[model samples]
Target: MDFLLLDDRTNLKLSIIRKLEQQYSFSERKDVLCEELNISQYLLERSVTEINEDLKQFELIDDMELVEQSSEIILFQDAQVSSSVVEEKYLKDSLEFTLLQTIFFNQFTSIKKYGEKHGMSRTVVYKIVDRIRKELAQYEIKLSKNFQLVGNEWKIRQYFNMLYYRIYKDSDELYNQSDILAVQELFSEIKLYCEEVNTLYLFKHYLLITLERVKRKQHYFLPNSFKSVEFDQKNKIYQTVAQWSERTLKGTNREIEVEIRGIINQLSVYRLEFCDLENDVVTEYTERLKQQFQMNMQLSEIGPEFCTSVKMTIYQHQFITPLIDLTLRAIDLEFFHERYPIIFEMCHTFIYQLKEDEFKFSKKSLFFNLLLVLSQQYDEETDKNTINIYVNFTQGEKYNRFIKNQIQIFDSFSIHFQPVIRPDTDLIVSDYLPQVTFSARNLIWLAPPRASDWRNFGNEIVRINRELQLNKKRK
Candidate 1:
């Protein structure tokens, strides 16, 4: 025979979830529960399974019924799995709420009633309650969330709460004083800074002051008034100070604009500088960045289509599985990243490859062409075979051949060319070559129009006809 014990934590969770039956979702409950309980998702799931089994043993079917009736658990599977986690989560949220209630509202009875109703020990309730109060007190006088301290730097009131909790835990005055005067001092300074400069740094200064108090615990007592406090709003000392000293000192604003202009001018003046390189390296690196950004956008836009489409199974089996695991792990790793080291390495490797190839542009051109074709052919008919065809066009030394073949398939048209820039190894054309232009080239780079505008091309053709007539006359 198995017996189920209704623990304080479990009871608190049930009460909390029932109260917030409308606002919270099953998934959110599960996540919050796991976090509060300090348990892994796997462990949380196992606990919920065990709890359900226990409930069945005790004939507590009504509890299960109550949960099922709650429409917040819209999906049966999610509702079934979330029971234990939600219970744990609710207990934590309740404790946090109770702490705030007791500290700010002076509603200490709520904490006592909560514990008594849930059959929890008053001592245990007080312990949890005290912890939250201590946390808030650390923030000092800034009790409300919206009453943010702004100066040369602004900080949220919550930061002060955390700070007070840290510094005054052992101090005698912390328990004696109901109102946190130290926190108020910082907040007042923030208000003054905001009034004068409309700056955010006052908050930062407040945090620094809090940190200093924490560092020197003996100097935790606040004086009646500060000497440097300004009497006037339009004081010359406050007006002269720059709001963002760090940015002004760094001088990155001027440098960035200058660098951007330099890059654009280089591209405009020497377009052939890109063409004087090998194909493979340049194409592989630049195409990777372009494809990565494109893939991200496509995934965001067509996410729902993947779930409902007939090719969902095929996409999951062939495409998503290969990348999703690594991608998710990389994202998780990014949260704790000090400086995005791995992505930086990938960028470095890509840039190095580009430099090694001596700046080939055709590879990038072919890559762009492949993307354009892929984007255009993106439909229900685009199976693995169709994708492979485009992929092969990008792979190896097949790009030039692929482009030339496509050009041949395009309709023939009249064209003329003149050498624009004749360097050591390559001749960059300024004018169209005679009888060389085709529908494919015209369509391929539709925006650029190869060398000249359509109107200019017509004028050039007319000019050539007159020149031919004159030469015939001279003959």
Candidate 2:
């Protein structure tokens, strides 16, 4: 079913609705739903309201209400309509969503084919195609006359994967139980190399997708280098995937290799250095980085765990696809240059020496990782008075000067403003909150720091500083 028409919030609402159906009529604790769904109470409350508004359109129910009491939320479903009817109505409303998925997967290659499959008239198909075209345009993708999608292949795949996850929420429903079991078995054999559940799911999803695409006679060309040499030849994880493909797929070795590479590219499977690459190579690169940066610390200084992490990062750059966007990374590089110019210069020099084109895609991530390693060594000796603040502003030079002044005035706070929000930030002093979720308890929302705003801003800063002190004391 084409559930992409329903955004994540709406999908979450429907999930809640379906859960309510199972209960028939009962008071379910909000915490239970929140824990199951991994959503905040604020988000659950908001989704409930939006879902009821949508339900009202079908005249299926008066409204689904969650009556809040002490430590519990009571859910009341409309008895007038059965849960199955509500589900069917939603499925019927989601045909356009399904159509988009069909187009993306190259399942239906023409308006006539789509119309035939869905029992829709030519006129209706044309309208849906037009809407799809407009939507693709927003992503700078093109919908051609024959229903083929024309765009950067990675971006096309990205959009498809995003929509797929938004609709299904997970990969469990995308494949049959047998196929899932097969993939799980393969994952188990190599679980020590990568044990993350999300990573396993992603690998399985792309593997299934790649198999389907290959069976449909859709093939990707392997570059001469990847085909000529067996990359990560000694890696057990690579060996496992390659062996599975040989036994399961009906293709030549070269074609199977291409499919395996395609899955790797789609999943961005880095952090495989545990099984790939030699220790000497990683040590050489690590030493070069330290020398270029003129840092006194050695690889051993950061200890074994962090040393492995840096090596994995270096290995990851080798398989990265070029088309993926690094705009945020570019912003991070700029911010690091402004805040810690010397360290950023060292990173730039080290990356330049590496001379790998793929480094362009991940130099920021590398720099950040290197920075963390350095911080581990240096932070122990440094005082803990400095608070890291992330400033989000775009007034150009004015914002720059304002940040400089703030850093000087609030010397105890290490102010680092960027075009993007960073996770390591102690406080967010932004002109406007970006449409992203953050968990900072000390977010100071204010206009650009003018002379008049400083008093109130300073008060907020003091409160946060005190809170931090209290937290430290409790710890």
Instruction: Report the number of the highest-TM-score candidate.
Output: 2
The Cα error of candidate 2 at residue 197, in Å, is: 5.9
For model 1, residues 1-475, the per-residue Cα lDDT tens digits are 0101224545533533343343323223556555665666666555555545544554543445323232122222334433444443333335554354344323444546767876788898767655553443432323333212222111222233323332332232322231234333433543553453223222332333333322322122112321111123254322322222222122354433332222222121112221212234333434554444343332233222322121221222121111111111001222111122222233334334544223221223222222333333332322111000111122334553443344332121222222222121111212233233222122122223433344343333334333332232221
Alpha carbon lDDT of residue 341, candidate 2? Answer: 38
Each model's lDDT: 0.32, 0.56
lDDT of 1: 0.32
Model 1 TM-score is: 0.23
Candidate 2 — what's its lDDT? 0.56
- Name the lDDT value of residue 102 in candidate 2: 73
Q: Find the 10 residues in a row with the least total lDDT in model 2.
A: 322-331
